[model samples]
Target chain A: MSFFKVEHLTMKFGGLMAVSDLSLTAKEGDLIGLIGPNGAGKTTVFNMITGRLLPTEGKIYFRGKDITGTQSHIINAGGIARTFQNIRLFNDLTVLENVMIGYHGRLRSSFWEAIFRLPRYKSEEKKMRSMAGELLAEVQLDNVADEKAGTLAYGQQRKLEIARALATNPRLLLLDEPVAGMNPRETGDMMDFINSIREAYGLAIILIEHDMRFVMGLCEHLIVLDHGVTIATGLPVEIQNNPQVIEAYLGEPEGA
Target chain B: MSERHRREWIYKLCTYGAIVGLFAFFLQVQNQADEYQIRILNVSAVFVTLAVSYNLINGVAGQFSLGPNAFMAVGAYTTALLTLSPAEKELSFIIEPIIWPLSVLHLPFLPSLLIGGAFAALLGFIMAFPVFRVRGDYLAIVTLGFGEVIRVVANNVQSITNGPLGLKGLSEYTNLWWSWGVAVFTVFCVTRLVKSSFGRAMQAIREDEVAAAAMGINVFRHKMLAFVVHAFFAGMAGGLMAHLITTISPTLFSFFLTFNLLVIIVIGGLGSMTGSIIAAIIITHAGEWLRAVEEPMAIGPFNIPGIPGMRMVVFSIMLILVMIFARQGLMGRREFSWKWFCGFLKIGKRRG
Candidate 1:
């Protein structure tokens, strides 16, 4: 069974079809790339899979269970976590607090227990704290765990977002423009961190990126979208050689 | 004992000790204090409760709500109906006969207060369904509308609320002990909620609702929780206010009541519970003390005729100045903790 799958997914916004009949599957431990120019519905796909947006038509499955249009929290609880293209850290909150929020879906303490600070709440909170610390450390942000998220540098904020997503203990992780605004060194560091976490946690990652080099270098398989429709899907080498993909990226042949 | 165990013990001891200390202090003050001082303290405690409860939705949950007074009205009216004697109820509704079921029923203070809070919470829960669907300014307007609707309903319901004349001669059961006790409890519950995972989720929702949802938080549920909890406490505060003031009227729970709470929170810092507590005290006391300015004063040789609403003018100026200089309010999301307090004292366990 596939680890995660999106079959015949389509999204419409008024007159615009944001995603058109897109289908992809990720096996356990696979790294897939969804790439396109600006406005290619890459983020829309992530949004739909995470249940932020209900697909106009689609079926989303995680480990053979239909999760299409499930409530966002339930989808996250079912072990799918995602980051946004625009960094969305709880800015006024500490980095540790931001990650702890990601652990909310896993917490079991009842409202009364928490309000009263019962032993169960204490233990669960402690466990969550340590786990948050670990995730912060994974993203190399443990040293600044107490710092407000808004005070972090842009690259660090992106890392914090990923750390927060990882804190959910997701089996399938969707990263939207993970290294969008990073310098080469920061981008390289992020790529390495992403690779290490995937290996360590046995995560299947589907990432959307504007950086072609990062996508080609990291992703094992690629699906290219243009004008909301898939133009190509295969290994990076095949995509690099495909004329349609080239035309989509660079526009139509000059002579024509 | 282990360090963690020791910390827990210390926490428990400190909490109970503080509660005991407050009771002893208030008990002494209740006997020695003048009626005016007691009244000021009672009002201050109610404002503290109101400010903290308001912060739960506006500050912690990041929903711009403007209808706390509506929930408070629910609590106030409910409590009044429940606690008023059948004879008193008949006397209150002089314009029209008191409703059958309400006129016959009466409850003691504590249970009546709880029921009032519960009713307010129910209203809050119902409001959240539509109110949470909109956000920012729209959320504010919707909630404000809810508040007005409540006021209008209270105005029309002559049999129950006595319409314009309002309910009077209410039992003054809200002593400083009751007011401050509930105020402390409100602070405790809110602070605990803010420190928990649920609190974090609420903050996350405040920061970015979409991102919060993507991170697995049930945004609507947390929003509803914050709203209902806030309304519950606001309701309790209203109940306390009614008993303390010895009257109930539709006009008392107006937008101005919410506006007063808003000013306190804005001055205190929207997301800071400690700020809310401090600001509540400051605003309430300041308003009382400023009464001197509202009265004719002999300054030097000339007797200056005090301007009516001068207190409000000065207060609005102060609020505007605070907004200009300290945009995040006094605390800016910071809370009071033992470590910080100790650090402030220049004593044991200095913050590193």
Candidate 2:
């Protein structure tokens, strides 16, 4: 059975079709890339799959179970986690606390137990703290774990977002522009980091990225979109060579 | 034991010791202090409870709600109705007799207070359905409207709330022990909550609801949890206030009560429980002390008529000054810990 699938997905906002009839499937550890120009609804597809937005017409299945239109939290709890295009760390919380929040869905302690600091809650809390520490260390952020997340540098903030998402122990990860505002060195490091985490966790990643080199290098398969419709889908090389994808990216020649 | 664990044990011991010492002091004050002084202490303790609970929603959860007064009214009235004797209810509800079961119902103070809190929490649960749908300023408006609606209902529901006459001659069960005990318990519970995984979820929601949900936090559920807890404590404080003051009226739970609470939480630092406790004590005592500004004064034989509401004007100015100087309030989200306290003490010793 497919690990994750989206069928005939569509999203409309009032008069505008934000995404149209988008369909994709991923097996266990598949790294698929969704590439599109601005306003091509790449992020909207992620939003729908992650349940941030309800598809106008479509279904999403994860591990062969229908999860379409479920709440985003429920989707995450079902082992699908995502990061925002604009990093959304809990700014005021410490780096460790931000990651701890990722473990909240799986926490076993009841609210009253937490409030009373019962043995179960205490043990769970201790485990979460150490695990969050391990996550931060994995991302080379252990040194600054006590600092407020908002105080981190841009690249570190991006890394922290990934760390937080990974803390949720997701089987499928959606990354939106993982290297949106990084220099070449930072982008290269992030690429390696993403690959390492994917390998370590055996995660299937679907990412939206504008960097052609990064997307081509990291993603085994590519789906190109333009004007809310898929233009091409295949190996990165095939997507790169496709005339429609070229036209979508660089615009049609001066004349038709 | 490890050094860190040893330090933690010492800190725990110090904390418990401090609490015991404070309770002993309270006992002495209860026996020795003047009535007015004891009353001020009780009022301060009640405000501490109010400010900490109010901070949960407004400060920590980052939901701007202006409905604590309504919750408090629910608590105050519920407790008052439950605790009052049947004869007292009959006497107070002259305009219209209180409804049947409520009129006859009577409970001891502790149970009455708990029931009041439960009722307030129930109201919070119902309100959360609609209230959590909107956010920020819209939430504030809806809650503000809710507060007004409760007051209006209290005025019109003569049989249930005794209408405009309100409950009177309530027995004063709010002593130093009760008020301070609840205050301590409120602080403990809120502090524990803020340190829990659920607390992190709430803070995540505060930072960004979309991201929080994407990270697997049930945003609505956490929001509802904080709101219900907030309403519960606010109600309990209201119950304590009614018993301490020995009277109640619909007008008593007006927007001004909420405004005062807002001032306390704002001055306390939005997300800091320690800040709330300190600010509550300061504001409560400052309010009483500032009453002199409202009374006529003669300085150097120059008689001056007192200006009514002058104290509030001064308070507003203080708030503005605080905003200008300390935009994050006194603590700026930094909680008080034993380690910090020790460090502070060390600094003081070195200076001396």
TM-score of each: 0.95, 0.98
lDDT of 2: 0.94
Give per-residue CA lDDT, model 2, range B1-352, as digits (tens). Answer: 5999999999999999999999999989978999999999999999999999999999999999999999999999999999999998999889988889998899999999999999999999999999989999999999999999999999999999999889999999999999999899999998899888888888899999999999999999999999999999999999999999999999999999999999888888999998999999999899889999999999998998999999999999999999999999998898999999999999999999
Q: Give me candidate 1's TM-score against the actual structure.
A: 0.95
| Interface RMSD (Å), every candidate | 0.9, 0.6
TM-score of 2: 0.98
Candidate 2 backbone collisions, by pair: none
Error of 2 at A66 (Å): 1.5
Candidate 1: residue A132 Cα off by (Å): 2.0
What would the per-residue lDDT of candidate 1 be over residues B227-333, giving only the tens digit for each residue?
99999999999999999998888999899999999999999999999999999999989998898889989989999997889899989999999999999999988
lDDT of 2 by residue, A137-188 (tens): 8889999999999999999999999999999999999999999989999899
Worst 10 residues of 2 chain B by lDDT: B194-203
| CAPRI class assigned to model 1 | high
Q: Best lDDT goes to which candidate?
A: 2
Candidate 1 Cα misplacement greater than 4 A, ranges: B1-15, B298-303, B347-352
The candidate scoring highest on TM-score is 2
